[model samples]
Target: MRIPLIAGNWKMNGSLALIEDFGNAFSRTSFLSNAIDIAVIPPFLYLANADEAFEGTPVQIGAQTLYGEASGAFTGAVSASMLKEFGVHYVLVGHSERRTLFKEDDAAILAQARAAIDEGIVPILCVGETLEERDENRFDDVVLGQLDAVMKGLSEEQRRQLVVAYEPVWAIGTGRTATPEQAQEVHASLRARLRHYDENLADNMRLLYGGSMKPANAQELLSQADIDGGLIGGASLKPDDFIAICHAAG
Candidate 1:
């Protein structure tokens, strides 16, 4: 069975002290079970701090974003290799914020995903539809389009190292969430799409739901057959809530 992964996306939040505190708090909690794996995706600036803080613990540190290029004259851009130095295990690629705010196109996202895979980092590729697209009945088309774009040049081995996160744009940080049934349908469809490339890989891939997934609703969502885990947002900042979601996953 695919190991349930509860990854906390710190986004643009957190300070060194906060991360250290969280690391200490998380270590003290009884949430580190063999049934699941946990990761903390902090901002790039604090990756080293988190890495040191969470050392010797089950919690792994990840990067919120990374540039596609390995080494270039591109100022203010971080490469996958740079993240690897900090012992980063996972990288968020094509996140909704990257796609919507920074205008990262499909090809750019694909390049970033490839860079992460090439550097031996697991990329949590985010794919989902917007409220407008869903209302217009183009949900599957939009989501599948994003997935296909990333799969274009990736080898089967690289594909196996990926973790797809289905985070509907409308529900993200908007206080709205996809019902268990709604989320399951999209997850099931995405898994089916993966089968076209490699049936074994598709069956083993871990698909996570991200969109205001909190302690209150985590159990029901985790109970879904297709929904393996979560790419948490706000709730993740709180140690209790994050651990609660992990418990739910277990």
Candidate 2:
């Protein structure tokens, strides 16, 4: 069975003090079982501080974005190797914010994923459909299309070392959420597609729900046969809420 993973995407949010506070609160949390894994995706600037704060804890540190190339004149770009030096074990690739705001296409996202994999980091590949695509009945086409773009390039071995998050663009940060059934359908579809590549790989890959998951809906969502955990946004900003979701999962 795949271990459930609950990851928080700070997404241009939080500061050193916030990290400190979160670290303290998380350290105080005693109910989170070993049955699930947890991660915090903070902005690159706070990675070191986060690593320091969460050191010796089970919670993993992750980055919100990263560059494909290892080293270059790319002044502000961070490389996977650099992230590894800071004890980062996971990174977010193809997140909706990166896809929509920064115009990171599938190819570019794949490059980042490969970079993370090369550095022994787990790139939590974010794949989902936009409001337009969902309303127009192209959810599967758009989502699967994005998945296929990268799946072909990754070998079976590489495929086995990955995680996926399905964040419906329409539901993210809009106070709206995909119903349990709605989210399950896309998650199952993703697993089915991966199964075609390699069943064992597909089963090993943890699928996370990223469309505004919170304590309120975490249990129902986690209860889904295909749904494993969450890629939390707003709720993750608070340690209480984040751990509550983890509690729901545990």
Candidate 3:
């Protein structure tokens, strides 16, 4: 069985104060232990601070994004190597905002994931269909296409190292969530496709539900067989709520 991983994606948000606050949460609570894996994706500036703050705990520090190449003259771009230097263990690849606002394509996103994977960092690949695509009845096709674009290029070991987050574009941060059944349907399909690669790896792989997952709906969603955990957004900015969601995973 896959061990649940409840990660907080701070997006473009973080602060020294928040790191300190998180440190307190980890130290004071036994719930943040080995029962489940925990991680916080802070902004670029606070990566070191977050890593340092959570150094002695089970909670890991992750990056929201990264440049695919190891080194380049690409100004303002952070490479996976730089992230590794700061102790980043996981990264969010192809987040909706990066795909929509920044126009990052599937190939580029997978390159970033490959860079991180090459550096021994785990990549939580974000794959989902938009509202329009789902409305047009292309949900499964679109999601699998995005997933295939990345998976086909990876080795079996690299594929196993990946974590998938199925964030239906329609539900993300709109104060709406896919019902447990709705979310499970997508997760199940994703896993079924994964099974074609290697049944054992697919069964052990974690497929997270990333769209608008919060404390109120966490329990029911987590109970789904294929929905391993969450790639939390808005709720992640709130320590109590994020932790509550993690606790619910248990």
Candidate 4:
């Protein structure tokens, strides 16, 4: 059975104080010691702070994003190696905001994924469709296309280390969530696509559902066969809600 992974993406939110407080509080919670994988993806500037706070706890630390190149004149861009120095265990790639707002194409995302994997960081590759795409009935195509570039070139070992989060664009941060059935359909499709590459990976790979996955709906959503976990947003900032979601996964 795949272990459930609930990763909190703090996004551009959080100061050093918030990171430290959250980590200290979360670390004290015994639920983390249960049969589940938990990670906190804080902003670039606070990775080390969060790491220190989460030290001696089961919560792993990660980064919101990273530059694809190892070293460059790209001012303000952070490399995977730098993140590794901060002990980042995972990296978010192709988040909808990065894709739509910053216009990061699939090629760049693929490069980022490769860089993170090379540095022994698990890349939480985000794939999703906008409301229009889903309405047009092209949701699957859009999502699977996002995966093709990054996934196609990965070695089997690299593939196994990845975590895929399906966050429908419309639902993200909009207080809307895909019904369990809707999320499961896409997760099943993603798993089926992976089977073409490696059966074991398809079976064992963890697929998380993103977009407004809160305490109230967590249990039902997680009950689906292919929905392995969640990539949380707003609710993650609150200790009770985030811990509740983790408990639901358990």
> For candidate 1, what is the TM-score?
0.96
Ranking by TM-score, best first? 2, 1, 3, 4
Give the alpha carbon lDDT tens digit for every residue of 59-134 in model 2: 8999998999999999899999999999998999998889989999988999998999999999899999888788
- Report the Cα lDDT for candidate 1: 0.89
For residues 1-250, write the lDDT of model 3, one tens digit per residue.
6889999998877778988998888767666355799989999999888888887778898999999888969999999989999999999998888998999998899899899999999999898887778779997678998888889989998998899998889776466557899999999999999887888978899999987888999999999989999999899988789888988997
Give the residue spans of candidate 3 off by over 4 A: 173-176
| Residue 181, model 1: Cα distance from true site in angstroms | 0.7
Candidate 4 lDDT over residue span 160-234, tens digit each: 889999988977556666789988999999999999898998999999999789999999999999999999999
Report the number of clashing residue pairs per model: 0, 0, 0, 0
Off by over 4 Å in 2: 31-33, 173-176
Tens-place lDDT digits, model 1, residues 1-250: 9999999998888898888788888778665467898999988889999999988778988898889889989999999999999999999999988999999999888889899999999999999888788889897689999999888678888889899999988775466667889999899999999999989988999999997899999999988898999999998888788878888887
Cα lDDT over the full model 4 = 0.89
Q: Which stretches of candidate 4 lie over 4 Å from their true place?
A: 32-34, 173-176
TM-score of candidate 4 to 2 decimals: 0.96
lDDT of 2: 0.89
lDDT at position 88, candidate 2: 95
- Model 1 scores worst on lDDT over the 10 consecutive residues at 169-178
